[model samples]
Target: MTGVVSRAKGAPVELVEIVVPDPGPGEVVVDVAACGVCHTDLHYREGGINDEFPFLLGHEAAGTVAAVGEGVSTHAVGDRVVLNWRAVCGRCRACRRGEPQYCFATHNASRPMTLADGTPLSPALGIGAFAAKTLVAAGQATIIDTDALGGWWDPAVAGLLGCGVMAGLGAAVNTAPVRRGDTVAVIGCGGVGCAAIAGAVLAGARRVVAVDVDAGKLAWAQRLGASHTVDSSRLDEDGVVAAVQALTDGVGADVVIDAVGRPETWRQAFYARDLAGTVVLVGVPTPEMQLSVPLLDVFGRGGALKSSWYGDCLPERDFPALLELHTRGRLPLDAFVTERIALEEVEAAFATMARGDVLRSVVVLDGSGAGATS
Candidate 1:
């Protein structure tokens, strides 16, 4: 099989012949249809995530089951599915408490996908799908109904539900639980931030304020249903807070989401919420980053500060429902698919993403071509 591999730190990824072994017990092999190029893959290539070299470099994917290993009865050949990084273990403490989204023991394929020389390659996020085929724990593949809306949906668009999109949408819908008539503000207008904005709108927020340094991204946020936008490029933290509050009747928003993951943006989110409002952090921060806030404010504000892990989503429940909403023309999932490129064009896609040129550059492994299909 052919897949993208990052062989060294900061080196460009290359398409290479690889070996994907047959699924082991409780695992399944998938014929990848489409995969989204995400920031996490770039982080792996830069060795920011870990020193795991020669990593298989894509995870956000949707595909069809090609084969199933022994003891895997949950799925079978030909099932349309979306790949998820978190495959919760049923016995984990979180799972026992009915909080599988926080399950401590997520499962992945025990065996590694190796290079042509038999060197073990770590699959990015444990379910590499940049290749024509990949192996993952059966639980990692959440089946989607291709038959929905009379089978007119595209898997390439559905693949976005696997990672970044899901995280952002879940952050607003699940973590903050944005309610009807509530005012919501989302910081950072990237793929995640735009999704958060959309989620707030779908959840019936009366006003959605999108804050971002990029004018293009802010426009994108507006298309995703934001009622207002704040260009944070020229604004200080206090200014951003003031702008958000002004949109919410000088009381701040009911929920403020920080999708930028920087100290400055976080502070803006903290102060851009109402006294009892919620602040949700869905962005990924570097390890060296530290946050400092006034202890008195923590008590005086009397609101919750939460961090979302994959939007605290359960794939089984969220993926299908969100897709259904998309099919019904309620959710703008198609807007996220900025362009489509072949699997080998991932390197170029990364550059495009870094330049803030597109929301998502998906790799259409099955050769369906890029862009959304109704």
Candidate 2:
């Protein structure tokens, strides 16, 4: 099969021939329909996550089950599904406590997807879907009812629920638990940040403030239901905080989400929330970044400072429900699909993403070579 591969650190990704083996026990092989080009894949290419070379990049995906291995009774051939990176292990301590989202022992396919020369390839986030077919643990495949959603529901849009979109939506809906009439502020208006804005709206937030350095992204956030927007590029941290407070009766927001994982943005989120309000950090920071805040303020301002990991989401419960919401026209999932390119165009997609022009550039792996809307 053909797939995208990152062969070296900071090197351009290549479309190469790969050998995907049949599923092993408790695993499944999926005929991938669509996969989103995400920052995580770029991270892998740049060796930000690890030194694991020859990575099979791309994770956010949706597809149909082509085959199932032994002990995989939950799914069968032809099941339309979204691919999740976290396949919770039932015996993990977190799972035992009924918090499978934090399950430490997530499972992946034991066997590796190799290159044509028999070199093992590391699948980014453990469920690489940049190819026509990929292998993953059966639990990673969350079945979605495409038929019920109307047969025309685009798979490219459905695939986004597997990663960034899910994380951002989960950050607001599950982590912060945005309440009715609450004032919420989301920092950064990328794919994740816009989703956070949408989540805040779905949670019935009376005021949703979107903050970002890019004017285009702020516009995207508005379309996603933000009541106001703050262009952080033109303001300092204090000014950004004040702008958020100005929108919310000078008390700050009830919940402030930092989707831009920088120290300054985090500080803005910390100070942009009212006393006893919640601050959720959904953005991922680099290892070298350090955070320093006043110890006295930590005790004085009594509120929760939480970090959301994949929005504390359980795919089984969230994917289908969110998809249902999209089908009903409540959640504007289609807005995220900015473009749909063939699998070979992933490298160029990265450039387009860096330009901050699109929310998501998905790879339509079904040989369509057309945008999702087309």
Candidate 3:
């Protein structure tokens, strides 16, 4: 199969022929239909994550089950599925306690996907969906309703569930749990942030404030259900907090989500909420960045400052529910899709997404129709 490989740090990924192993025990091979380009892929290209060379990029993906290995009964050939990175082991301590998302013994493919020349390829987050096919544990293959008119979920929408939407929606509905008539604020109007805004609206938040430096994103944020928008242009911590407070009777929001993940935005999320309100950090920050709030503030805050990882999602529970919501038209998952391109166009899609002009650019396979699943 042909896959995107980043042979070296700071180098462009090459579409190289790779040898995908047939599913081993407990694994399955998926014929990928579409994959969405995410910021994490770019981070791998820039060597920000690690020095794992010859990395296979692309994770957020939907595909069809092409084959299953011995002992696998959870899925079969022709079943449509979404691939997830976290495949937890039932024996892990976290899993034993019913917290599989934090499972210490997550499972992955025991065998490696390699270059045709015989070198092993490191798949990004164990997903590496930017390819013709990929191998994953049966558990990683979450079966979803992909029959919205293609081999996979309509590429135009099902593909986003591979990552960003899961992260954003989970952050809001699962982590923050915005209640009816609650005032919510989401910092960073990017894909995840906008999704959070939409989640807030769907969760019954009465006032949803979208914050970002980009005017274009803020405009789209409005469409996604942000009741109000704040352009974080010359605004510091106090300025942003004051603005949010003003929108909510000077008590700030009931829930503040820092989707940007920088220290500054995190601090803003910390202070932009009313006392006892929740703060959810869904952003990805560099390892070197240190959080430096006063210890007294932590006690005074009186509520949780939680970190939402993949929106604390169990794909088995979330993906099917989200697909159902999409099929019902209650969740506008399609609004996150901005463009549709072929596998060869993945590089250009990254550029467009980086500018924040596009929410998500899906790589639609030939048979799949655009945007219908959403």
The deviation in Å at residue 167 for candidate 1 is: 0.4
lDDT of each: 0.92, 0.92, 0.86
Instruction: Give candidate 1's TM-score.
Output: 0.98
What would you estimate as the lDDT of candidate 1?
0.92
Which pairs of residues have clashing backbones in candidate 1?
A: none
Candidates in order, TM-scores: namely 0.98, 0.98, 0.96
Candidate 3: segments with Cα more than 4 A from true spot? 145-152, 369-374
User: What's model 2's overall lDDT?
Assistant: 0.92
What's the count of clashing pairs in each model shown? 0, 0, 1
lDDT per residue as tens, model 1, 131-160: 999999999999987776557557788889
Superior candidate under TM-score, 2 versus 3: 2
Model 3 residue 124 lDDT score: 87
> Over all chains combined, what TM-score does candidate 3 have?
0.96
Off by over 4 Å in 1: 369-374
Q: Write the per-residue lDDT of candidate 2 for residues 242-313, one digit (tens) a residue.
A: 999999889999999999899999999999999999999999999999999999988998999999999999
